[model samples]
Target chain A: MARRGSYAKGVAKREEILDAALEVIAREGFRKTSVREIATAANLSQTGLLHHFASKNELFTEILRRRDEVDAVNASTDPEARFIDTFPMIIRHNSKVPGLVQLYVSLATEAPDPEHPAHKFFTERFEGFREELVAEIQEGQRSGEFNTRLNPELAANSLLALADGLQTQWLLTPTLDMAAHIEAAIESWRSDPKP
Target chain B: MARRGSYAKGVAKREEILDAALEVIAREGFRKTSVREIATAANLSQTGLLHHFASKNELFTEILRRRDEVDAVNASTDPEARFIDTFPMIIRHNSKVPGLVQLYVSLATEAPDPEHPAHKFFTERFEGFREELVAEIQEGQRSGEFNTRLNPELAANSLLALADGLQTQWLLTPTLDMAAHIEAAIESWRSDPKP
Candidate 1:
C-alpha cells in the first residue's frame, strides 16, 4: 500500500491542477483552453497532469464534481434551515469567484447536447436543484413561513431560473449587483407584509 | 445596378439560407455545425452561400439581427402599451420556436467572451432589453399599474434574468409551463394585493 504522506501529496497536487484549470478556463474559455496550458500552470509536465486526469473530458468532469461538492458544503451551513434562506449568502459568495461561475455557465450551455460528456451531470444537477428548492418551498408553505397561495413548483422553478439567469448576466456585466437582485426576488415571495 | 427581380430573388435566397442554418444549428450545435452543411440544406453550393454571407460571423450577426427585428415586431402589437405587459405573450410565442431558442441560448453563453464574434451583438441586445424593461417598469409605476416601491432597475434586471433563466430550464425540460411561471412571478410584483 502507498504511504499516507504520498497519498496526501497526490491529493494536494490534484487540487493544484484543478485550480490552474479553472484559471485558464475563466480567462480563455473551454474551447480555447488547452490541457498543456493547464499542466504548465500547475507546474507539472503534460505526462504528470495526465497521470491525474487521463483526458480533457476527465479533467472537466472532476472540476464540475468538485464545484458541486463546494456548493453542497456552502448550502449545508445549517442543515435544518430552509435552502432558500441560504441562497443569497451563496450567491454573494459566488460573485467573488467569477472564474468558477464562467466555467459553470459555459459548461452548462454546452452540456445541453445529449452527446456532450457533461450532459448527464448538468441534467441531474438541474433536476436535483429544482427538486430541493421545490421541497423547501413546500416545507415553508406547510409551516406558514411562506405564502401558501403560491404554487410551490412554479416558485421553485422561477427561483432557480432567477439564480441562473442572473449569473449569466453578471458574467457579462460584472457591475451588476447579483446578490441584491436575487435577495429582492426572494423577498417578494415572503408571506409577511414588508414593513 | 441589379434589376428589381434579381434583388427580390437575392433577398428570398438569403432568407432561405438563414432558415436552413437555423435548422442545422438546432440539430447540431454551433461547434459541430459547418458551413458546408448549411449550404447543403439550403440547396446551394458553398461558394453560392459565401456570396450572401462572406463569413460565418457575418451570417450569425445577420441571424441575430433578424431575431431582434422579429422580437421588436412581436412587442409592438400595441405601441402605447408597456413592454413588460407583453413579456408573457412574447415568452409563450418563443415556446413555439425551440430551434430559435436553442440558437439564442447557445450563442448568448458563448458571447460572454469579449473575443467571441457575437459578443457585441449580445452586449447591445441585453443593454437595450434591460433599458426598455426599466423604462416600462418606470412607466407602470407612474401609471399606478405596478408597485411604486419597486426599484425599476432591479425589477428590470430580475425580469430579464427570469426570462433567460426560464428559457434555459425550458430547453432542458420542455414540459415546463414557462409562461405561467413568468406570469406568476410578475403577479408577485403587482402593487395591488391579489383578491
Candidate 2:
C-alpha cells in the first residue's frame, strides 16, 4: 500500500511539473525558456526534474501531450463542438502561445527522422488527426455543411496542411492572421456546389 | 588584369562548390549529409569551402537559391510556362530531392527568428513567391483558366501554404503524393463556376 502511494505521488509531481512548464513556456517563449527555468517554476531541483523524464526530447514531447490534453478539456466544455468548429479556436489559442508554437515547429522539423525520439509521437499524432478530420468531414458532408463532391481524405489532408503551413508563416509575420486565412479556406469549401 | 582574373576564378570556384553540394545532398538525405562530406565531394577542405560562404546558414541558403535558379532555367526551357503551370513540375522535382526538402524545412523553422541568418532570405522569398503567384493567378483568371471569382491573393497564399505543408507531410511519409494533392487543389479552382 505504501509503494502504491509513492507511485501516485510521483505521477502527481510529474503533472505539476508539466503544468508549470506549460505556463512558463507560454509566457517566456520556448526559445528563451530552459529546463532549469521549468524546474525552478515547479519548485523542484534540476536533478529532481530530470528524474521524471528520460531525455530532453521525451520531456518536450510530454509537454506537447499535456497541451493536447488541456485543449481537449477546453473542447469538451462545448458539448456540441465538432472537430471543424474547434479549429479556429485552437489556432487562436496557439497564437497567444508563441513559445509553444515555436517548440512545435522546431520539434516537428526534427521528428521526421525515424531515429528522433519524437518520431513515434508525431507519426501517431498525424494519423490520429487525419482520421478525426476525415470522419468529421464526412459527417459535415452528410449534413450539407460541406461540399459532398469533395474527397474527405483529400480535404482533411489539405486542412491539416493549411494549419501547419500557416503557423510557420504566421510565426515569421505575426500580423498575417492565420485564423482568418484558415477560416477563409474552410468557407471556400462550403460555398462549393452541393452534390 | 591579374585582380580581375583572380576574382573570376573565385566566382567559378564558388559555383563549382555549390553544384557539388547540391548533387551530394540530392543523393544523400540532409540529416545524413555532412559539411565534411560535401567538402570532400567538391575536392576542397572543409575550411576552404567555408571560406566561400559566411556561415553554414548562408551556405544552405545559397544552396536553395541555386536550386531556384536552376528551376527557373528549366522553366524557361518551356517558353510558354506560367508560374501555375510549373508548380506540378516543381513539386515533382522536389520529390526526387528529399535532402533539399529536409534542409528547407529545418532552415525555415529556424528562420522565424529575426536574428537567424536565413531570416532575410525567407522573408524576401515568401514575399516574392506570393507576388509571383498572385500575378500568375490573375493572369490565369483573365485567360479563363481559373475561377474568376476567386481572390488572387487568397489563392496564392493557399497554394503556397499547401506546397509548404505538403512538403513536411511528404517528408514524414514518403508515400504521400504531394504533387497530386496540389494538382487537385488547382483543378478545383479551375472547375469552379465562371464569374
Candidate 3:
C-alpha cells in the first residue's frame, strides 16, 4: 500500500499537472500544443509529465474528467432548488476557466469519432445532462412551478443544446452573459404553460 | 484577365476537390488528412491540387464559406416559407455530411481565437444568420403570424444556441431525431409570442 504522505503528494501533483494542461490547451489548442509544452507549464520535465499521463490523450481525457469536478462544485445537491439559483456560479467559473471551456469545445467537435476517447465523454455528458434536466422539469411541473404542456424530454434536450451552443459564443465574445441567456430561456419556457 | 478555360477548369476542380475532401475527412480527421490524401482521392497529385487551390486553407475556407449556400439558395427563391422547412433540412444535411458536420464543429469552436483564419468567417456567418432570423421573425409579426411580444433578437440567438447544443447531442447519439427537436423549438416560438 502507498503511504498516506506519498498519496497526498501524488494527488497534488496530478491536480497541478491538470491545471497546467488546461491552461496550455486553452491557449495553444490541441493540434498546436504539445505534451512538452504542457509539462513546461506545470514546471515539470517532459519525462516527469509522462510518468503521470502516458499520452496526450490520457492527460486530455483526465482534464475532461476534472472539468466535471469543476462542474460539481457548483452543482446543487438538493435537486429541489430551482435551476435558476443553481448554475450562475457554473457560468461564472466557466468564464474564469476559459481553458476548460475551450477544451470542452475542441474535444466536443473532434471527439465524435468512435475511436476518440472524448467521443464517449461528450456522449455521456449530454446523456446525463439531458436526463437531469428532464427529471428536474418534470419535478417542476408536479410542484406547480413549470408548465405541464412543456414536454420535459424535448425541452431538456433543447436546453442542453442551447447550453452547448452558448458555450461557443461565450468562448468567442466572452461578454455575452451565458447564464443570463439561460435565464432568458427559462423565462421564455415558463411563459407558456399547458392547462 | 484570367482565361475563360482556366477559370472554368479551376472552378470544376475546386468542386471536385471539395467532394473528395469531404469523403476523406469523414474517414480521417483534419490533422490526419493531408493535401496528398485529398489529391489521391481526386485522382490528382500534390502539384495538380496545388495548381487549383494554391493552398489547402484556401480551398477549405471556401468550403466553410459555402456552409450557408443551401440556406441562401432556399432564401432567395422562396423567402416566404416558415423556418421549420429549412431547419430540418439543415439538420438532415448535418446527419448526411457527418464529416463536414465534424469539420464545422471543430473549426467553429477553435475559430474563436483571433489568430484563426475562420474567425472572421464565422463572425460574419453569425451576424448574417442573426440578421436573417430577426427579419424573418419581424416579418412573421407584421403579418400576424407571430406574437408582438417576442424579441426577435433574443429568440434568434436562443434558437441558434439550441441548434448548436442539440447538434452536439446528435453527434454523440446517432439515433437522435434532430429535426423533430428543432421543429418543436419552432412550435414553441409560434405557440405563444408573449412567452
Candidate 4:
C-alpha cells in the first residue's frame, strides 16, 4: 500500500542520514560538519535533508540518542560488576566508533554553552553517572573487597575522571595499554601503604 | 632594514593568524576549522598563510605550543608548588577566560591524537606532571598529613584525572564549586565506612 511504502522510505531516510552524519563528522570534525554535506553524503538534496530533521541540533540529538541506546543495552547486560569491567566496555566501544568518539570529546567541550543541547545531557549524565558509580563502589565495600576507609563518592569521581582522562591520552597513542593502565589504577587502590 | 621590517610584519601576521584560528575554532568545531578561513580572518591571502606554516598540522601544533607556554607561565612562578597550587590556579584562571577553558576541554579530547602536535607535549606533560603530583602525595604521606595507606602513584594519577575531569565539567557549568570539589576529593582519602 502507499502507507507501507512511505513508512519504509522514512526509515531508510533516517538511517541514511545518520550514516551520512557519521561520515561527515569523521571527515570534517563535529563543528565544521554542515547539514549540507551530510545531505550530499546521504545522496539527498539539502531540502530533502531539511525535510527529515527540523534543525541541525535535532540531528545531533538523534545521534546522541542512538548512542545512549547502545550504551543502555550494553550497560544493562552486566548490571552488577566491578568498575573494572564497565570501564573497559566504555573504552572498547569508544575505539570502535572514532567519529562518535570525536563527537563526544568535541561536544564535551561545547557542552558548557548554555544553548547547546548537550549541556543538559552532560549535567544529568555526570550527576547520574556518579551516583551509579558510587553505588558500584559501595557494592565492593559490602563484599569487603575494597578498603573500608575510602570514600565511595570521591573514589567514584576520581575513577571516572581517570578513565576519561586516560582515554584522552590513549586516543593519541592507540597502542597504549588501557586495560593495563586501569589495572595499575586498581592496583593503587589495592596496595595498602606501608603502615 | 628589510630583515627587521619582515620580522615585525611576520610577528604581526602570526598574531593575526592565531586570532583567526581561535575565532574559527570557537565558531566551528576544530576539524571544521579551515586553513582558508584562518588565512582570511588574518586578512591574509592563502599564500600569505602558507608562508607562515607549511600545513594545517603545523598551525595546530603552534596553537598547542602557545597554550602550553601560557600554562607554563601561569605555573612558572612556583613550579615546585605547582602540583598543589595548579588545582586552585585552574579554578581561578578558568573563570577569567571561558573561551580558553572550552578550548582546553575540546582539545583535551583531540590532544590524544598522536598525529596532533600536542600529543607528545601532553604525554610528556602528564609524565612530568604526574611525577610532581606523586612527590606531593609522598610528602603528604611523610608529613602524616595524608593517609599512610595511600598509593602515591595511584593517588597522583587519580588526582590529575579528577582535576582534568572536574575542570571539563566546570567549564560547562561555571557555577560549580571547583575548589570545594578538589578539597572533597582530597578529603575522601579518609572517611571510614560504617560497620
- TM-scores for all candidates: the values are 0.84, 0.93, 0.86, 0.66
For residues A1-195, could you state the per-residue lDDT of candidate 2 as single tens digits? 467589888888888889999998888887745678888888987788989998777788889889988987876687677778888889888999988998888888888888877788878888998999899888888888888778889888888888888888878888877888788778777745636
Worst 10 residues of 4 chain B by lDDT: B25-34
Which candidate, 3 or 4, would have the higher DockQ against the true structure?
3
Select the stronger candidate by TM-score from 1 and 4: 1
Candidate 1 per-residue C-alpha lDDT over B125-144 given as tens digits, one digit per residue, 9 for 90 to 100: 88998899888778778878
lDDT tens digits, residue span B58-94, model 2:
8888888888888788766877777787888889889
Local accuracy of candidate 1 as per-residue lDDT tens digits, A72-159: 6876777787678788887887887787777777666667677666777877877887898888878878877788878878887888
Kindly list the per-residue Cα lDDT of model 3 for residues A85-180, writing each as its tens digit: 575657666767676787777777766677887877777877787787888888778888877778998888887778888899777677777887
What local distance difference test score does each model get?
Answer: 0.78, 0.84, 0.73, 0.66
Ordered list by DockQ, greatest first: 3, 2, 1, 4
RMSD of each: 3.6, 2.4, 3.4, 6.3
> What would the DockQ be for model 3?
0.75
Error of 4 at A20 (Å): 7.6
Off by over 4 Å in 4: A1-47, A75-85, A138-148, A179-195, B1-88, B110-124, B127-159, B179-195
In angstroms, give how far residue B110 of model 3 lies from its true place. 2.7
Per-model DockQ: 0.68, 0.70, 0.75, 0.40
Q: Give residue A52's error in model 4 in angstroms.
A: 2.6
List the TM-score for candidate 1's chain B.
0.81
